[model samples]
Target: MAIPRVKHFEITLTDEGVAIIAFNRPAHRNALNGEVYKEWDRSLMWAAQSPEVKVTILTGKGKLYMGGHQLASTADIDESKSRKAVKESIVCVQSLLNTLINFPKLLIAAVNGPAIGIGMTTLALCDVVYAVPDAIFLTPFMQFGFCAEGCSSYTFPSRIIPPDNFISDVVAIATKTTNFPPIAIFQTKNLVRARERETLMAVNRNECEVLLER
Candidate 1:
């Protein structure tokens, strides 16, 4: 399939069904804006509907994986939110995160370099996270005087990193997993994350509430 182009990222689908979504705004350190969020939501929806995509690999361009949110995009969101607005925002992001967490196809995050903000937290949602030797992971929530988003508060302390190595450890497991029947894979994935959906949504609401109060 032809790759889709946007202001913030690139999505490439391979014949082998490995869809790679690379953040392309290296000039801004891959900082996410409203457009990126829109593209992300749409891309995930496309992937969910397309049988051609069996797995997705998310990464970034240039030296840094991602930096933080774009100021303009979040400024209005922070300034004018009512209770209903806050709830809506929370529900929207939580829905997307849940879709990613419970994605039908496999999800992999290749942290090419420093990953901060959502970049750091999103690693926890991916089925596999591969970081280069120099890759640095940081939440920067405390540094920014914010709490958490992307469910890192729950995932980070839990040592969400699976296995010791991505290739030998995770790939081997994924190979075995995919070798199984597709229905079996879906069931196993669903069972593994059965309660996590509710937990993550609750966490997202809580975090948003705290942010609103602060």
Candidate 2:
């Protein structure tokens, strides 16, 4: 299947039916912006709908996994545009969170390096996470005067695999997972996530509201 093209993310579908989505903006340490969120939503939807994609892996290019939201994008917001920008950001974030909350495929995260802010929070949404020993996970939301926006409050205490070869190891696991029967994979994930789906939706909505108020 042809994966959707994205400017901010590099997406590839392996023959094993794993869709690898990497944050490609290494020049900025893989920090996310409105554009990145939009592209992510689109890419994830494509993978979810593609029969060829049985699982999806999220990772980052270069050294850092993700630097979180691009604070620099808001640095230039003027008094007149501040409200509008904030509203737009809230919408984009809410949409992205909703996508992750409802995604049916097996989701894996390869934390190659530091995962800050949303980077850290989003790992809770993935089914599996593999991190390098030196990789840092921090959510300085209070320091930044922002609340969590990725259902981290409800999804905390997430697990992670400390692996030596992060990317290759993650891909190997994903490949093995993809070899399972497709219906079994989908139904098992659906049953496991059924109980938390509504709760996650509520958390995502509450988080976005709180973020907007902040």
Candidate 3:
């Protein structure tokens, strides 16, 4: 059967308890944009709530996985709205990261291509990540003149290292993870990451405030 495809992403039902959310913006190299986020939010909710979904494999169409924030034309910032705009934007990213981190099911990221800025951070949120040999991972926050989102401030310090083998390894572990009882998996995730919540919260707030100033 042909797999189901969403306008902004693809959802492929695997053997029981696993799904793949593949980004669909080949032309833009799957850059993160408002519309993509809207769809992503809904898709994520579906995967999280659906009874049969216990694992989500996140990847992108074409070679590149995610190109980070979409490039936008520069606009003269009105003093009145600049802070509001920055805060609102940062809020969206923060909320998404929070959702991903707290999601009950396991998430595996496949970096088929370069993962820049928010893309790199998003990978860190995944329970497992598989990267192609040529994949480049970078956080370009300094160049973008904004603080990092997706809590890379903390995630990178720990998760983004060791550079595991490719998609095959991810598949192996994902398959194993799906076999565990959901309650045990969820509780273990909580127990392991519980201490990081406080740090993550502080960083989220600090990053937003700094973004407004930048």
Candidate 4:
């Protein structure tokens, strides 16, 4: 029997004109390794240049949002290889981020579970995010023995969770074991509004429709 090839993601345009991009690797907690990153970069660039997609909703397949990068996949990689992999991952993620940020359509994360590491950092770039009540948001750069990527170093502290002594807060949270509730982070300074997952989905749908109508 031949081994089957898996698609890293699937894209579908809803009747309401929302482009749904599902990260489809539930078994590995949707770990986005190299192939997934390449596919994501290509797909987002395609979508950004296309006129058909009016909005993009990014979600993970199955229960959890994403477990972040595939740590297990790198078990055999040496330090040099690991560095190269991280660099490539950053390029791919940054490419998609820059494209999405500049794209004409709205970008939203339909976060359903723990959005860890890159999963958490990616939301820093999303225009809207619908996080589940139990959503676990973590940035384990230092913990994971890696520096921050995804332009998160610049964006996360300055904009996403701006607070009193914001730079201090940024330094305080930039570590391995720290996990912060999105709402608690929001309340610290009141720069963002994180709604219930259901409410956010509704708001996403409504906002998409409103944008389409305009």
For residues 109-153, write the lDDT of model 2, one tens digit per residue: 899889999999988888878888778989999898887778998
Ranking by lDDT: 2, 3, 1, 4
By TM-score, the best candidate is 2
- TM-score, model 2 to reference: 0.93
Question: Of the pair 1 and 4, which is ahead by lDDT?
Answer: 1
Report the lDDT tens digits of candidate 4 across residue range 102-185. Answer: 444456677767788778877866766665556678888787666665545545412343223432332333321124343453
Which regions of candidate 1 fall more than 4 Å away from where they truly are?
A: 1-5, 72-92, 157-180
TM-score of each: 0.77, 0.93, 0.82, 0.64
**Alpha carbon lDDT of each predicted model:** 0.68, 0.86, 0.73, 0.59
Residue 192 lDDT, candidate 4, scale 0-100: 37
- Find the number of clashing residue pairs for candidate 3: 0
Clashes per prediction?
Answer: 0, 0, 0, 1
Rank order (by TM-score, best first): 2, 3, 1, 4
The better candidate by lDDT, 1 or 2, is 2
> Considering TM-score, which of the candidate structures 3 and 4 is the better prediction for this target?
3
